[model samples]
Target: MRVSFLLFAGLLLAAVVSGCGGGSAASSEAASSGNTASGFTSSAAIAVTDPVTVGTLKGMSDALVVGDHIVVRSRSDAFVTLNGQPVYPGTRLSVLDKQGKLVSTTDYGFTLAAGYTGDWVMMLSPDGFIMVQSTSGTRLQHFDAQARLVGGVTDLYPTVAATSTTEYAAAENGGAVDGNGFWLATTFSLLPVTDKTQYVLKLCKFDFSGRQLTPPFMISTSALHPRVAAAGGAVLAGWLEGGGGMLAMWSKGAGAPTIRSINTGGSQPYPLVLTTDGKMGVLWNGKATMTSTGGVMGVMIDNYGTPLLATGRTDLTQETLSAHWDGNVRATVIDAHAYKGGIAIAGSAVGALKAGEPITDVLVLADYTLGTDPLSSSAQTILRFTLPGRAALGPTPVLRQMLFDDHAVLLIGDDNRLQAVYTTRNR
Candidate 1:
């Protein structure tokens, strides 16, 4: 299938946060699309409308859109928004149906008391596991697709944090990174391990029965900004190796990461993606060129981490959109995915976005064939949507935590309301 038809079904209808049962209609429309040379039968704009209201609590945090339902973590008394408005409290951990109805609710024993004040990290796996971590940093709780409680909080943080001051502090600051389905947490030095100085980020894999499959193993990376991805197959996990400027991958039998620098040096892998063959691909955005002209390109690496294609933008003028981060403004990567015959990337143009500043006309770009050896680039300015009345994602926005397809989904909380927005196109 072409990248155009690969909308997040959850991401496609996920934007109907304020609306009701038009989703099944929309999903049927997209799925039954005609097949064309460009791989799309029809090109249409996304249908986002009819804002309604429901819920009990003040608001919810760590929101996620799974398939056709909306799930979010909240205080002991979190509110669920049916349609568009907040109804009441204790509606935390709710599942909103396609009709914008609150179908089911779950609570992880969290209360907003004096000593307990923190957010829950709610993440969904591809195999249908709703993993949740509590307000207390060390505790972990999760449920299955049927919303049944599987177990209690597992205290592995203290054991992981024993060697260093930054391993797994009990402070409710940084939580786990939900990379696909693999749950990842950062630590300095783990037990029965060496390389004591370099920072280590490890992953925990779970079985169908919600059991930890493998012990926490150290990935080759030591930096935080350069993203990591779990592309299992021959390659288990991969991350941007900071010092060497390489796209590192650790296969199943490998003792260490197989490192191959995409740009030699002076390159930051904006976001990492896994191809259909379980290989590694990334959006190569930032560079230290003379005029700084690498404008959010598509780069694909082999399963062993070899750079096959390094595609810069052909549809854009470098000077206008390709601005580098010397100190101030910078580029932001919203999302990227592998299509039928290539890779498609999207997000902010270079130097396009700033925290708390409204973007009047935001356009997301999707390059169709960016994974070929010679870089055959057929790009599309897929969708253009704007926030209502000039709204900005404030400085502390929890956007990076959510998964995005062509349509971007957002949940904004202000004045006791959880405002949801979904942006997609009909093309």
Candidate 2:
């Protein structure tokens, strides 16, 4: 995916103090009047509508939450227009949530320059300065968010990475050539906080009060691109290892990271998810054995990098592999039967005990609880969807992405269209 860079400049203004800040009458009056002179408004919503189907095909590049709104970007050369005006192509489309309706839309016109997995959208402008058009792509601002304008935009590198709920890491280059003919690597500027240079990676934590909790924590890697995932007060930082197309994971307070020892052997491993509950899962292509004879296998790892499961048959020709992980830490693997080519093999945390359960099947949602073994929990299937006509399952066949939100499962099928299946069981 191509990440675009656009200069965001508007005005300078202080953040509006909310009633929650203190019991001052000024703050109370501001709250009573509902005057959001600051770009950041207390109440505003966003949403998507009549999304353009690019080339008759739908593609979801990336998405993130800005306040109460959900912003989504498409990888295809597609632009979403509200009313009829075309939103800026490559710029992220905002979806605001208001009461029960989508209140407004805003286009920041900034292009993401890196992969979307670790990157997200952030609201840089204050509520009033950030004017959003209904569907006309018009620019308006009720308030501004940028208070201090650093050096001319040219000298400022607007690279940003989210570090926590209210904190972000931003860096800039001084535009000076170093001995290596590269731009003089200037110290990363910890924005919205202290101006002191204490660390190289420019690790700094800032709360909504604009206070810096800690000095920047330096890293050995000069080009360390820290990817932060915050959950339950734990922060996991993931970054790409130099030259080795592998990922390195480290926790903020959990000391050094335990690198993955297993070699991709050549295939690239994709980091599918890092759940808020601290469960990390990765998917990669490999060989596995199906019978006692011998064969290849598909590889999967747990949060601790433990190889808990593998799939594949001895015959080099049989390409059978599929896997899915539910909340209970149970993984379901579907593979082709080695001897019986027509018979599909289905294996789950519980199916492993059933010996030879049916193969060639679909997922069935059932209530499940964590078992002692973690990987072998039982789940009752409340519903199932069958897929017609079966072929030799490949390692990536059933490895489609599935996201669970609000008791609803959103599956991105091979066709790329999102199918949201919700569970209606009464609690």
Candidate 3:
């Protein structure tokens, strides 16, 4: 395992925009009431923490809060040929305590081949196990509550052997459930049938034991950018189709998945979030034709694949700021969390840029109640933070709401350094 570390001289502080108001820290009344009195109110103080060092990387590939410690998975910067196979970089897992102190670090010797198409998995199971599946899908490593690797299982099916130039975001092709196992929605090319090849999309479920729990469910012959989410014993698989997107909802004993097309403008749906109340929230970019500026649109759907809102859609960017994407400067949704009776959306935006100014990025956190029209005009609080440091945005920032329920953190990497901030529902 090759490890590299960079030491910083000064501390960077984030600039917070205070106009938007947040609700009380995990207050049930604030959560139950679907309203934000101020154009921006203070529910969470949005505390800024000093950057947590994790070494050189594009950005945090994935991050999840387990207990009070944060387990972060990052791909290293070094690239080399191992065993005659050109590879990208080795995978490293780091655990950090509440005070931004590093607890432990583990380096998986395996490196993903260049142009690997499979999406990796790092999820926390309900029983307090941190499951890390390699991009190859050949090995499943388990970590105890203390972030220690106890043992691992191997040899189910390897998905990373095939190389494709097509790029993918983290968890773009797969997702996991808390208590249940994870699901993968992918396409496989079948052998030549009548001298012609055919591609088929499939959704498969596998438990932590590295065992396939159910037979693969057929989705469609062709689909792009597949995403999955499961909750309340129901699973949702979605993919880009035509100019919009298609969704399929299925349960354990259900006959088949119910399919529907969603109108999300031109951008693909992202970050599928299943709430505790058997509701699913789908978010997408509402971009106009030939314009970099776009609004974030969201919709709430019940487990039965039925719309829950009046119009079945909420314009999140309208209540906040529009996400603009230029040649390099870009902003889009990253992650979200469903709270007791509300939900919070996290995004990244480009800060003010000049010829000689250090490039800064902004973190957008928008909170909304989960009642009728959660993101209604009067029900959302959007907060923006100008992050510290001069770094070019490549790897998207990683945002994870802590398990404590009252706090959330964002990991930003630039110039081979990692920085973080914590947001809370307090003044």
TM-score top scorer: 3
Better of 2 and 3 by lDDT: 3
Which of the numbered candidates is closest to the native, going by highest lDDT?
3
TM-score against native, each model:
0.57, 0.37, 0.71
How would you encode candidate 2's per-residue C-alpha lDDT over 293-387 as one tens digit per residue?
Answer: 11122322344444343143222112212222111111222221111111112222211111243334233232221222221111111222222
RMSD of each: 9.8, 20.9, 9.7
**Which should have the higher TM-score, number 2 or number 3?**
3
lDDT tens digits by residue: candidate 1, 1-427: 2222332223244333434322422211112123353433244333443223336532455555677556665545434465896434322566655444456676635332223344544556554444433323444555655455665555435533345544444332122233434444433332334454444555455443345656765554463333455554334333345543545565546666576555534444543544544565555544434334445554455657764532553331221222221112133433455444444343333222233443332323343443234232232323322334434433322221123444443344333455444434433
When sorted by TM-score, best at the front, the candidate numbers are 3, 1, 2
Q: Single out the weakest 10-residue window by summed lDDT for candidate 3.
A: 1-10
Compute the lDDT for candidate 2.
0.27
Candidate 1 TM-score, true structure as reference: 0.57
**Residue 340 of model 2, lDDT score:** 11
